[model samples]
Target chain A: MRLDLFAMALAVGLATWAFRYGPTRLNLSNMAPDSLLNRFLNATGPAAIATLFVASVLPYLEQAGGHEIPLALGTLAVLGGFAWRRSVVIATLCGAVVFGLASALV
Target chain B: MSAPADAPVTATPQPMGFRDGLTAALPIIVGYFPIAFSFGVSATRAGLTGGEAVMLSVVIYAGAAQFLALALVTSGAPLLVSAVTLIAMNLRHLLYGPALLRRAGKEASTRQAWAWAFGLTDEVFGAALGALARGKRFSEPMMFGLGLGAYAAWVSGTAVGALAGGGALAAYPALDAGLGFMLPALFLALLLSVLSRVQIPTIAVAAVATIAGTVWIDGTAGILCGMVAGALTGVLRRPHAS
Candidate 1:
């Protein structure tokens, strides 16, 4: 293993380690409902998660690759499966099947 | 909190432990396998050995960052560039902690809290939050068990992908190509699931902000911008709540 990779992981571990002191329901109880910090986190919370996932995957989308049709069809199948069933297993299986068939032909 | 009118006063139930966590983590384990497998395939394609690919999954455990690192390695970017970009990419995780801690319902001592933070990947955070919304009680043991199960799947999957890169799957071009879609599909699943539990307004705002950001900026920058826009909308929409 490269020293830098290990170091990077360790840094992430330590950075999150500091979050033990972050505000939680227990501490927030003492504050007002609309307290400045509390309000900020709440609003940021859902958005952070949504944007985070998008940002993480967008890079992969930008990578140079071909065969967009199969990828798209399979992805849509997965999303549609999820919307219908709300089950990861079913959606992934559906996507895999779509992806496999598309890949075979395309 | 008080019991309902018809309930008995003493209703202490079985405490959630490692076993419960293992069960809860099963879905995540199943979900992680294909992505980790893809990562393993990519890493080996980038000239990393099986051990190296598996090591990244074992130690780094950051999915996007590892993929980025493979890009860096393939392009021969400096090590510092890899490290800095990774830290920047994962910075959003800081937001997950406090929000998840609140949803998980109990405060931990510093030690247990740190362990929870260490295991707090995006999928795990989504699962933990979804579990809360579904009314499942949270416990430290359960959380750790969930993390461990997912961790094991990722590491082993990486190993399998890397070591088996030259095997039957690769021999079939279509099979190898199809597996590449695994991570994105998994992400889509998590996104849809999490959106289901969030308030409608928050979801709409987040969706709009993300779309605008993606069009206006690069991927990482767009994500940060979208998050800020979504947060601003959330704040404007609601004066209180987190």
Candidate 2:
């Protein structure tokens, strides 16, 4: 019964709903593909994902201490698995397995 | 399914209906379960109650943003800052509906847009776009079915995972550590799925900016800097040239 966490959830929910539902109402179907807004929106997905990926991995890299090899191999397994199967689930599972096995060996 | 030989011709294929949409959502449901479970595990690990974890899934429903929210909350970040950062991280969602509608073209009906649009997650958007590209007619019932299926899977998966409790994986030290890699791996996989020559620069710039910001300021500041810097670079780049 943490009121604060519930409150945060509701607030984040409302804002996310607005982002999801608002644009459909605006009817921006005619927006030029090259418009700044369009381009920014287009680029935002990859850029944000890239940002999150780096932000998440950096801390782990910083604290690798003795886990660097496992970490590196796990990342490579993810890349290799995705390149081969083109499935996020498979790739992530592969990476986790590599990470786990490497951790045991290391 | 192929059309009957005697079916009348039309510019668009017949609507696939709610059942088909649910069927189409099978892959998404499979994909979402593990991630949603991870989120639930992470949420409880971050000190949120099981109800709170499920509530976050039931409400916010954005996978990556939920992970980010958990991080921010655990760090004792200001509430407003957490909310704003989550919103910024999800801003790409604003483009999904318009992009889908534009692809669906003038004949598509958005009269029920307000209701169906609420389910336009990245994967949902990708699924819908893929459906349209396959020449299927758009229908609100189908969108409803797809969204409902994914939403149910997410919320239910979270509940189950939360019940597994925060330390459910603690006994498996390797697995627990590996779970930490899941988010980064997931994000990277997603980015690669949509990678393009045109997008390389934006990604590189964003990655560099995020690293710099993280080194000098903090993770949150780095995310903001990366997003703004990468987007601006994208705006400046010519469409045909990288």
Candidate 3:
């Protein structure tokens, strides 16, 4: 293993640790008001939807590849699952399974 | 001097329990698995060892940014350049932290907040926020479950990808190609769910603006431009009523 890669990983882990664990120790969560919290919650859903659109759709249309059918089918399954069950886990599993099966067939 | 010293402390209503948090976070975990798998595949292609790839997943943890950083580092970019570029890419986390602080505060301590901040990916933030919107109290165990599940999936996916890339590549050549489409497809599904008339147009404008900017300035600048455009659109559209 390259020493540099190891060093980089260690640095990143430490940084992440500090970021994830530090604020709680400092009690910063108590500082925010209820109105602010409400706003944050409201914003998250839209942002998530936005992110999903970008991450999933843009690359597929922009990049040509053989896996398009499976990708489409898998996505459809996920969407269907979400509609039917309103369950994220089910939707995701459906997508993954469809992708895997389609890949195997092709 | 005048306030009552023995005012009763009202108990905050707990949101869904740890089970619900884990359930809610499942989508993110699923979404991250393939992305992390791709990262491992790329790492091996970039000539890193298996141990190195796993380490990357465990340590760096920022999927898209880490992949971009790895490419830059491998291309012989200066360490300073890579570092600065990465920080810029991840600056969105600053917004994430402050937002999360608002909702999960009553149950979260400074240490817990820091931990949550570390785990604050786009997906986790979304899940937490979604839960709260439904009037759920943001619980620590739920957040931990979500974070831990994502972490495990990422690390495990990387390991699987690394192994496949090393020797299994010959048997499962299509695995790599198939994995490539997962992100775009996933994103599309997400977009479809979120795209209202106002938001879709705004996103399109932002995407086009970013693409155009990339043609001129290049690199991560496009992402920033896109974000700014989206933020402006969001602010402008806020008064129209949802």
Candidate 4:
């Protein structure tokens, strides 16, 4: 019940909510198909994913001294699993299994 | 992994309903539980009470930023400074809703956007885009279901982990490492699911920009750099119909 923690949570929560909530309220449905905005929006999905992918993976890679082989094989397993089954759950599970086994064995 | 310029939109997809969204959210729920658990452990270990740990998940709901907030607060940083820094780190989220709706096109309803948008976390946003790529029509109920499921898992996981205290997860070291890979694996799967040949250059640009930015400045800057770089690359290479 620290007042500072409460205030920080309230402020961060409100601001974060605003960030998540503000853009959806926009009426971007009427934009031209080839408009710059449309193009940017279309690309945002892949771009965002790629950005997150790199951001998420980098830390592990940076710290991957003893876990290098496991990490590499796990990544390949994820890719292969998705290619074979087209299921994110299956792919991620496969990756985790491979990573966990490899880590245990290595 | 296929090289088709676009994923085939097989038909007028049925608008996803609540059940469908919940089903789709299962993986995210799984992915979130361990991370949230880790966060709960970390928050408590850092001196916050179990209630406060759960409160952060319930309120802030930003995954990594909560960790950052813990460090800042525990280090006696000013409250406003900590809040501002966390918000700044998450500015990339501002693009998710608009970008999602744009891909949904004019046919999608936004009548409940104000309510559902609160659930639009990074994974939720990516999953929604993946649904669109699969030709599913957007429904507010589905978004609600998806967001709610993930949110519930996160909060519940945190509460359980907090109650269990810090040493709860330390016993399963290998499991802990594997769980750390879930978020990246999830994102990679989502990216590959919707990937197209036309977007390759944009992905490359984003990946390179993100790496460089991370190396030079910070992770947040890297994300922004990648997004802007990839978006511009996409616009530049997009074909004109007229």
**In order, what lDDT does every prediction score?**
0.64, 0.82, 0.60, 0.79
lDDT by residue for model 4 over B1-242, one digit each (tens)?
12265867554656888988998899889877866876787788788899999999998997756766775677666677667656655665777887898888877788888888888887898788898888888899999999999999999989987897866657887776675566677668768865888889889999999999989987666766887798789889847532
Task: Show the lowest summed lDDT stretch of 10 residues, model 4 chain B.
Answer: B1-10
Question: All candidates' TM-scores?
Answer: 0.69, 0.89, 0.61, 0.66
Question: What is the TM-score (0 to 1) of candidate 2?
Answer: 0.89
Which stretches of candidate 4 lie above 4 Å from their native place? A1-25, A84-90, B1-32, B42-53, B60-112, B120-146, B216-224, B235-242
User: On a 0 to 1 DockQ scale, where is model 3?
Assistant: 0.22
Q: Pick the candidate with the highest TM-score.
A: 2
Candidate 2 chain B lowest-lDDT run of ten: B175-184
Q: Per-prediction count of colliding residue pairs?
A: 1, 0, 23, 0
For each candidate, report its DockQ versus the true two-chain complex.
0.37, 0.62, 0.22, 0.45
The interface root-mean-square deviation of each model, in the order shown, is 4.8, 2.3, 5.8, 4.7
Misplaced by over 4 Å in model 3 are: A1-106, B1-35, B70-85, B95-101, B104-111, B130-136, B186-202, B213-242
DockQ-sorted candidate list, best first: 2, 4, 1, 3
Best by DockQ: 2
Fnat across every predicted model, in order: 0.38, 0.71, 0.19, 0.65
Least accurate 10 contiguous residues by lDDT in model 3 chain B:
B181-190
